[model samples]
Target: MMPVDANVKKIIAQPLTAEAFQKYGQVVSVPRGDDGQSANNNTAKRFNFLGNVQNLRSDAKANMCVFRCQPVAMPFHMRMLEKHQYSNQMFSPMNAQRYLVIVSLGGDEPDLQTLAAFVADGTQAINYNAGCWHHPMIALDTTIDFTCFVHENGTKDDCTVTQTKEQFFVHI
Candidate 1:
């Protein structure tokens, strides 16, 4: 862990909306009505190609993972932010539960002043663009399971973590 800075920023979580979240990534939610039919003859709502699922180098490969995350209480202090330089990351909730999504513009490093927070219901998921800075999983209310997609290889280039000079607290 890094040393905490003297500055603290308070962030109020707002309702997640497609328009607001577009800059960071796509908001993946089940579309209304049946858009397509799967081979099983069931109604299917597909959100395709939400993000760039590729490795930074040709030698690496992308993989899918299931994460069971415990819920974090409100007024949680955010100490660090991370980004995947190689591939885009996607998170889809396996259960219907509300959660918090915090993000900042992608760059060589994270800018605390640009941090934004959004509250997402179980119906909503997100595909963070490559290099997008974001806080780690922040499940709320109850424990939740998420299906994650990203490049996986034993390399430090996969993810980068930066400690903030100023602390931020997320409130719902």
Candidate 2:
């Protein structure tokens, strides 16, 4: 165990699950056999409607990008959170091992009391609902290349960031 900061909130990351993460976003993965259909002459499987991209603004354009992220040094300190008020965001790991997903629900600012941390394995992807507050992806173990999706119109509303008065520390 490590010493704690007087003003830091310690959070233990739980395993990411669809039911537990519904409020903030959807968990995407290969569906169960009955939930998907065979495609390409049974050479592949297709899972339909796992999640929807919320592009609320008329001017917003969907964008897909690849981010090569560096691993975060532990114990991780979370100082701020960000959100897209007009669009949802998605991240799929191309070559990640494990990562952290931290989120909170509130009106304009994040509700620290509702703060939740989840540890996601390589196969899991997450899609955040519009206006959902979330910390940036924190890659663990090694550097990762993640395919990210979002809607943008080159406006400030594309993303809003808020710094927390009390930072949170994650220990996995």
Candidate 3:
């Protein structure tokens, strides 16, 4: 296997915009609460994309919620691998599902070549250009309204899951 440093690739900084946005739709700005209100930690930061409410569970759901991720390397002097987590099921329509991610808080810029590996051509998403890799999905937290595309052929694909154990330390 390649050395730890060899496997680690510099994360490219990308943004979620009409030009960069792969999925076409009426964009809804998920209002983020106060800056200081967001809990911060070494592992990652958590936030409620929407307002909280009470709801109940039921049979399986058929809906989709997608978001974008970006690389923010300016916070770190050295680039690190982007880590992520995922679940076996999808939560949509009427279920409270949630996913958390640690963006590349690093205050630096990544090269275009690095970003070449990560791109969504046609998908509904809110890009998070943190550069750092993050969990694919944690699923629902509470019932929420979401809409997105679904690959019906069942041959859905993502570039690939290149797993690695890379820890990042963010100083507040």
Candidate 4:
């Protein structure tokens, strides 16, 4: 029973596959702008420790949307601890809100679907595993600031388990 010190030579991020994460959540790509800017609006505004904002809406027809941030980020190196590997902790959803990880850093593209490789423009992209550990930003060009959209449901186990670390590589 001792603490293990490891070196993180690199940060790996890869496209989340339905096969790898079966019964888990789906990976939907955020729409990008045409030739230049971002097309999707609704991105959250970062306020920091200043305060927290919570919005819960139920219009009966519109669709119940939930956005919650633990204010957590990807550490320098992501490693699977012993705790997460044994229990069903590896997979299990805190809530049932559909999430969307939108990026505005440089030219990194979203994994709209496929294995999700950036079109290769120098910019970096990121993919989240419902809640499986991920390195916030792939870091290729600009800062990686994102707003995650999650759902609000009594659904206890929304995340499924897999047997691999986050896999990401440059296409260029």
Candidate 5:
């Protein structure tokens, strides 16, 4: 692996807010009463129309899965990023905990310089728009189980990964 540049890109993690994260995806959270509403006989608070689950291809299918992810400490180097061309990916924590969300924007092939990191508290979840580049799950503090919604067809085309020749470490 190539060593990181002398001046590696350092992204400071920011609080995950819907406005800040809008370009990349939707921030899934229980909206305030003024912004959202109660559904299912007031048993649940709904934040509707979060993100589009785009599966343009014929073979694509939407499915749900639970991901148990280990914690990733801070100051970790990131070398690769991935994108799902056929669908949007959503992750909501089953347990209350904070986690890291890293993303870049530039269509199918993202520019490393555009990378940004955000810290999402347990109350928040995120949905990555189709073809958006993002790092894999990074749970912080403790192990976490996330309910994930994604489109897949059991093929390599489901995802595309780009590896950096140099490493980039995230800092909070």
Candidate 6:
């Protein structure tokens, strides 16, 4: 609600885990269990129901994309955040060392006080819930490619962007 200030909030990203990220999204990874059944004639393991996709609009269709993200320097300054009001966005790392995921809890805009950051490895993936406020995917150390999935109707409402009241610096 106010103009951006000079004060910078510092956040140290913690390891990404299901319990820690439950309120904002679901972490997609290999489930720990022998529940996975053998597939392809005992050559591969198949785990079902890892996560669900959220598409709340009737006219919207699922869209899959690949994003090649460049490495970001340490103490990354975060000035803006975005959210998909009608569909959940998922990103699966193809080849990444470690990446940062920043999110917040708010109604109309991001609440700086509620900002949280997490570091996810290449083996881990995440699916942000619809309307969840989050910073754009941040690649650290090396360039990474991600397979993303979301729903879109070819309109501005597909994604909502908002400027933060204060800049936040993300530190690993």
TM-score of each: 0.87, 0.94, 0.25, 0.24, 0.90, 0.93
Best by TM-score: 2
Steric clashes per prediction: 0, 0, 39, 5, 0, 0
* lDDT-sorted candidate list, best first: 2, 6, 5, 1, 3, 4
Error at 142, model 1, angstroms:
0.6
What value of lDDT does candidate 3 attain over all alpha carbons?
0.29
Error of 2 at 122 (Å): 0.4
- Candidate 1 has an lDDT of 0.83
Each prediction's RMSD over C-alphas, in Å, is: 3.1, 1.8, 14.9, 14.0, 2.3, 3.1
Q: In candidate 3, what are the lDDT values of residues 1-172, reduced to their tens digit?
A: 2234554544443333334322211212333464423455545445343221211222223334553323333322232333211111221222323322223222132222323222221222333321223334222233234343321212222212343334222221
Pick by lDDT: 3 or 4, better one: 3
Stretches of candidate 2 exceeding 4 Å from the true structure: 1-3, 33-35
Give the per-residue lDDT of model 5 (tens digit) for 42-89.
Answer: 897666676667776888778899999999767767889999887899
Superposed model 6: Cα runs more than 4 Å off = 1-6
| Candidate 3, superposed: residue stretches over 4 Å from native | 1-4, 21-146, 153-172
Which residue ranges in model 4 land beyond 4 Å of their true spot? 1-25, 30-76, 79-131, 151-172
- In the predicted model 2, the residue pairs found to clash are none
User: In candidate 1, what are the lDDT values of residues 68-139, reduced to their tens digit?
Assistant: 989987788888999988788999999989999999995887876778999999999888888889998899
Cα distance off (Å), candidate 5, residue 77 = 0.8
Ranked by TM-score, the better of candidates 1 and 2 is: 2
Residue-wise lDDT of candidate 6 within 1-172, one digit each (tens)?
2233568777899999989998888999988765698999999999877677999999999999999999988878888999999999999999857899999878789877889999999889999999899999999989999999999999999999999988778888
Candidate 3: clashing residue pairs, number: 39
